[model samples]
Target: MPILIVEDDNFYAQRLKEVLMDFGLEATLVNSTQEALSSNIPLYAAAIIDIMLPNDPDITGISLRESRAGYLSGVALARRFRQKVPNFPIILFSGYFGSFEGESWARDNGILFFSKEDGPGALKYCLQKIGIIREVKPRVFIVHGHDEHALIELKDYIQNTLNWQKPIVLRDEPSSGRTIVEKFEDFASSVDYVFVLMTPDDIVRNVKEDDKRRSRQNVIFELGFFYGQFGRKSGRVIVLHKGPIELPSDIQGIIWIDISKGIKESSGDIRRELKI
Candidate 1:
């Protein structure tokens, strides 16, 4: 069954539709509360309503609060849906509204709330909670040192072999006037899996010891970032190292695949860890 999406922002609504499509789900988008009320509610498996919406013809002259046209329009819509179907599934998805915004009311009324800032993964996770979406194609992010060859091989294995979407490489993406951290988070927040390549890209010297080959500082930073995001036991972060590079002792209890013999040799390990 199709899912109902009530959102005024066309861009955001299209994005939500795409996210649903990725999981082989269909969506019916309605821009206003009026249209949503008129939609065939029984045709949809569930409904995702935006918290803020503009006033429509049905409530044009009425006050925003009284007519339920603005900020809490989704709340009003959810009430109406519940009135029609006592146990209809409804989710309130919003970018402007935080956890404190009508969250308590939603919980008390049997409605799920998700913040867009948490990214599409969180929305899908919510869907999984409600038993709407069951399958998940792991979104892959690649963090690598200066080893372009290793990056290409691993990307090829992920795309061609695993048949997953092209793994995201930060360096290849456009900056688009955003800060490095902003750009990183824009991509990183969407991915569930990470592949950090610890290549011998840098040489570091200790207080009284000779210089030893190690992964770049940026690579290590990204590794830690993803590790913190997914945790060690989540099995979402994969570390691929080449050569006799000095590995970080701080990271423990995670699978480390050696690609010294090329990415092909470690395909079995990768597949086993990813369970595909």
Candidate 2:
């Protein structure tokens, strides 16, 4: 896996680079915000960024979820790549942590957020984001709850039945214990499209537990991290709702996922959602 370390400090940046190399990964170190952007790196499994780069931008690159400028910062630019090319992970690091901005405003404009001073915290977060599986199977997390057999069956259909690339199904494995926000960074960094594997059970579980509140919160807070750090959008998000849903409060209202009734019917829906 390749990790892009974005920091202006040679000592710290080099230190991080060496760590990644020692751990069987490639590291590309850059010392300035300008240089980081100019690289136009095609894709990266993870990125370690300095949240407070001297002249990076006034707007929160570490918390952008949506964009009005369409194209703003290098981090913001990464979103375009993420939609077309998923699996690229991004880490927004800073020696300091900052407070969040407006909720609705942050959602429409922010995605992911992080602080750099966690003591290799950024690096650790990056590694976890790109789950280090032993094999080379295409990693795909079936985002459903317990007893999501339909999802499992759908997965089998896609792989064993349809002869599609077999994806490493995401279950309650120890690795999945990592925070979803961190995982999204990895997915955004590396995967092309996140199959939102939703089902009636998922909707039921989320709705019963006020998942709408949580999902909305996730969109604003977590999504802001990606928006600010990697610049992702709702367009890049391919949603598969088990049932109809309301745009939760805040920016969740901006992105819409089409709903489907069953497994077989859902497959084509996702294809259409991604416009594949």
Candidate 3:
């Protein structure tokens, strides 16, 4: 009933839906050209169509079980849709936009072309150009330990100061009958960035040294999870180290702000890293 999306990859399609939701828009998702053609196109405002798609046997009458020609079926689908409605809004969203053969055709026919690499902000901008109102917010996941005060301050900064959506704190979220890991993942996978709080919440001593202050084990694990998911160089993971906490040696070069004094002290660096 909002935007009709035609994407073949399930993972990418779900991610696109999440991004649209973050933009305060709802989307009806269809997996193939056949599905899109069958939908009530007139009821939707616009369509975000993936350029590379598998052949829909229902429409093409040819099986693409072992064929590569179906890769461009989205182009043919767009052509058919254009014929049906000349002025209908359409966006050709693709991961391979640079190498797509129909780039010129899409431009010539007045279709909006967007690359997956350009990210959700650009996609929202494209929809806006087509007269769709979008309210965008950064989805942030905060990974903290027993530092309740620190967590509250961080959330306040993100919500009240930065004016973004409420930052996700796993423990404070409703479980919804899911295991802790499942609940954590449900929030983690959708967030655009992760803020790890390295607070001195635990004291541990190894055989080689005296007891040292460290973050809770759970915090350490969650930090590793985010690092593994987004990688250290992506700038998606921000570490706020508080005090002289014992950090894992393997993650030495990760970008971190010394929040040992306070979150306000590192507010400038936080904004700069988040690119707000």
Candidate 4:
């Protein structure tokens, strides 16, 4: 099923949308409980419903930790949906309380309740159970030179601020770190995206010598490795030049988003670009 997302608050709903994209499923945003109840959600594979609605009057229940309603509101919602749609898989979410009575309620009603505290992990768990698996984010590899700081900042933005899943080769898993030759061997063909920061520092430092080509050699090797590895799949690579080094013909074909000059506004820019 597709994923229908019902969130009362605008910001929370938007955040859930980004998480869904990573799973290759886009969420349908319904603002109010009325909108959610009125609309047809069957087109979706699953749904994310915020239990505590603004106009909903189950005030007797405790408040949710993140929002105003607590465990009780979620339980009521879960119970209500289960009675109406017995077969449909429904996800109940609450930001209010850590102890979600929703799970017990869901078990009774044959629905699933996820705590907001678990964050994406909860969503990931839910997706896994439903058998949706694959990498939706562009696997980006940044070959750093002296200006590694800029790359790191951008990486952080992508991971932390942007909430994008970046499998950083060095940072994420260093133990399995293979030689540069091994890393780029199969990379180009499999990689959907690549960014080459052809800055003066990167190029000048990586310059080749007869016996010892330093930083320049490293950059060249990685680029060449991708060129060859990608082989027929070379069109997916993105080559970003920092100063002026021309991309080889193979990689030159791919489209690129240049962050060499730097992003004008990080948080807002990314959110706007991705429509978070």
TM-score of each: 0.57, 0.41, 0.57, 0.41
lDDT of 2 by residue, 1-276 (tens): 577777777897888788677668788887655566556566566666654343334433423333323122334444533554464555544453232221223244333334343234334434643563122323343444343665676578557744546543433333566685565555444432244443333232454466431233333343444344423443434444545444435555443444444556556655565454
> Which pairs clash (backbone N, Cα, C closer than 3 Å) in model 3?
none
RMSD of each candidate relative to the true structure: 8.7, 10.6, 8.6, 18.0
The C-alpha lDDT values of all candidates are 0.81, 0.48, 0.78, 0.54
Better of 2 and 4 by lDDT: 4
lDDT tens per residue, model 4, 50-79: 766653444323234433353354455445
lDDT of 2 at 103: 22
Task: Rank candidates by lDDT, best first.
Answer: 1, 3, 4, 2
| Model 3 per-residue lDDT tens digits across residues 1-276 | 588889988898999889888777889999877788888778888888888777757565545642236666677778877778888888887776343465556777777776676556457656766877644677789989888888989999888988889898887899999999999877776676789899999989889999999989888899888765554544678999888788888878767799877788789999899766
Per the 3 Å backbone cut-off, how many clashing residue pairs does candidate 2 have?
33
Compare the candidates by lDDT and give the number of the best one.
Answer: 1
In model 4, the Cα lDDT at residue 84 comes to 61
